[model samples]
Target: MKILHLFNELKFSGAEIMYVSAAPLFQKLGCKLTVANTSLQLGEYTPAFKTAGYTIIHQYIPHALLRQWKMRKELIQLIKEGGYDVVHIHRSDLRWIMSYCAWRTRCKAVYTTHSVFRSHWYSYPLHFMQRWTAYHLFHCTFQTISDSVDANERNYYHTQTTLIYNWYGSTRFYPATKEEKKQTRLELNIPQDALVIISVGGCSHIKRHHDVIKAMPTILKKYPKAIYLHLGEGNTLEEEKVLAKSLNLNQNVRFYGNQKDVRNFLIASDIYVMPSKFEGISLTTIEAMACNIPAILYNVPGLRDFNKEKECALLIPESTEVLAKSIIELYENPKQQSTLIQNGKEFVDAYFNMEKNARKIFELYTKR
Candidate 1:
């Protein structure tokens, strides 16, 4: 089968990361996979795909009306001439337009919603059009990253939307060895006695890296040697830095912007917290749990799907005190930490296997 994966940008976002991880699985199953990314610059994961021997198509599409029209024409031409069996969109924004183009060629189209809820002004209208007109344009089939997202889209599109959990690089992101953990901590300049709390993903307002920084003072009052590492860079990196400075957490809060490999950091950390405003089965949260690190996340959409209760993880409300208190409690209680480690790893290994979930996508593709 010939498949074209249309991504909005080439950044190492959750959806893009999933594509990078799942492309090999699809190829291993005898499907021809091509990644076409619409972004001004080549994405971080572009090289990874190229190194893995996959064809990557990068086209710069400007926001100007005329340039967008030109890009859309080119996209349609690529799908039509490439003779792709399916055109899958990783971002929801362009699904309507792509669906229309697919319709012109009579090609089957599929869309994956990287976000569970609509947040932007553009998304509000785009989502409305998708939910209402998908049958006519998008063929009414959708893929969501979580159960909550699947239900939300099913209620709106009333089509055959399915849940395909975001696959992680479990082989690389597994639990750290004793020597590996010590080396990573030493590399990061963390003392053996210090408590390291980490969060991996883009640093954005939606991700609420600021809230993690806000809760740092409280965490430090109890564990002064505690260091909060916010890995990954975004527009909000400076904003979070300013907030950290104002809160006098400059020493405690450390921002490592845009890391290509976060496995070492994940394995080295004592705790992983994803204090996001919202999510759709966060890749970082899964990666953390795969590393046997106790995760603390809010009872939000994405994280909730992972059985992120007290058994597997420390689920809490989106309060600074609540997050800090949860962290302190978990840090102080070794027994509870061990339970979370054991159960969270079990949950992740059982439910979030990348190969198994990638097969589900292939099944969705062939179902049509």
Candidate 2:
């Protein structure tokens, strides 16, 4: 079967990373996958997709209103000519156009909701119209990656969706040995005895990376050698860097932009921290848990879902003081940390296994 995965701008984000790790599993199910860059310009993570053994194609969809119709026509022609059986869309911006084109070409299309978003008052009318058109007219199906996303879609679109939980690369994201951890820290130029705190995923406003940075001063007071590893890059990266510098926390915070192997960083870290405003079940958080690192996530929609039992991770209020306190508390309490680690590892192993979830996605494709 031929499958085409569509993205607005391919980047080093959760959805992109999850697919890269799961693509081979899909291929194992006898599917040929093609990824299309629908934005005006290609993204930096394009090479990673190509490395995942996908045939890369460009179907530029301009943001201009007048140009979308022509681009939509070209996209329809491409889908038909490529003989794609499934067109899986991972972006929301131009989904209506993509779904319309996929339907016009008579291909089964599915849109995966990777995050829960709240529409503004003005966007409600357009959201309703476009969503109605996509679900009814285009016959496009929706798939949500988390319970929060599923609930949000049901509330907004009034539709039932395929709820497929997100997964991570279990083999690559497992715990590291003592020697491996020491060696990784040495290679990364981090002190062996220093406390390492990490937060992976794009540095976006909603990610609240700045919240973590703001908490660094308080954390530094407790553990002077505490180091913050900021992985992934986005619009708020420079602003975060400036914030760190302005507060004299630059020395403690290391901004290592997008990384290919974040597992090494996770393996080296003592605690995983993500103060995201929300998430669609963050792949990074699960990866950290799978790596046996206790997590401290903000009590938000997507992040809070991981704390259903309140045993796997420490879900605290979104406050700089609380975040700093939680990190210090987790670091000081090794027994508590160990409990979280064991429970988190088990939770991820039980639900976020790539092989299992990838098969579910493949079934969705084949069934259609």
Candidate 3:
């Protein structure tokens, strides 16, 4: 089968990573997979897609209505000429273009709504008009990454028929050996006795990287030798760095902006934490778990869905003192920490094995 996947940006987000990881699996199954990004921004994940040896097409569509129509024609022409059997969409923007093109070409359409989507007050009228009227595309298979996001989407957007969990590529995200960890840590100039914590997400208010930086002082009160590593880059990177400096955590916090081998940093770290205000089964959480790191996350919607609370992670509230104590507690309690690590590994192996989950997606593509 020939499949064409669409996205607004090819950035290092959950949806993009899932598409990049699954494309190879689909190809291995004797299917042709091509990626199309409509965003004007050439995203960071584009190189990763090229490295994986898949064709990537850029349409460069923004919010202009006339431009959208032109892009819709471009999508239809591409799908027809490529003889694509399925057009899978992972991004929300320009989705109407994807849907209309697929409908025109008679290609099976699939859309997976990642939870990063939220309606703005200014765009309510336009959104309401689309949702209430028959103008919105509905003749397609719909999916979401988590139950909570699925519920919210179904109530507001469209009905989702499947719940596909986010899966991490096993080749990149896996447990490191003793020697491998030692070498990675040594290269980073990190001391063996220091407590290393990793939090990866693009710098943004929603991701709450600043919250983690603020929580660092309290964490340092107990574990003074703690090192908090921040990964990912975005518009808010300067704000987070400024906040960290203001809180006197400049020494304790190391901000690495968008590393290609993020899994290496995950393997080098002792624990993974993400206090984001939102997510749809965050791909980082899955990758951290797959790398055998005990994850500590807030009890937000997406995290709550994945939490066995004490089993997979130390799922806590958005409190600095509580987060600090949880880190110290997880460190001191070897038995509990080991249990969390084992359980995380089990969870990743069972639910997030890339090959297994990608096969499920391939099956979805072959339907109808």
Give me the candidate number with maximum TM-score.
2
Model 3 C-alpha lDDT per residue in residues 94-137, reported as the tens digit of each score: 45566677889888888777783668889866655543331345
Clashing pairs in 3: none
Q: Rank candidates, lDDT, best first.
A: 2, 1, 3
- Stretches off by above 4 angstroms in model 1 are 61-72, 119-126, 136-140, 156-159, 308-310
Q: State the lDDT of candidate 2 residue by residue for 255-291, as single tens digits.
A: 9998888999999999999888788888999999999
| Model 1 RMSD in angstroms | 2.6
TM-score of 3: 0.90
Global lDDT of each model?
0.79, 0.87, 0.79
C-alpha positional error of residue 37 in candidate 2 after TM-score superposition, expressed in Å: 0.9
CA lDDT for candidate 2? 0.87
CA deviation > 4 Å runs, candidate 3? 64-67, 116-138, 155-158, 308-310
Instruction: Write candidate 1's Cα lDDT for 1-368 as tens digits.
Output: 88888876677678777777777788998888788877677877788777665678886555454455567777778887899988887756666677877877778788888766644775566567655676554574578878768876677545466787777877778888888899988998988788889998887778888778888888888889999988987788888888989998878888887687788888879999998877877888888988989999888877777673447878799898898888889988999899989988888787778999999989888886
How many backbone overlaps does candidate 2 show?
Answer: 0
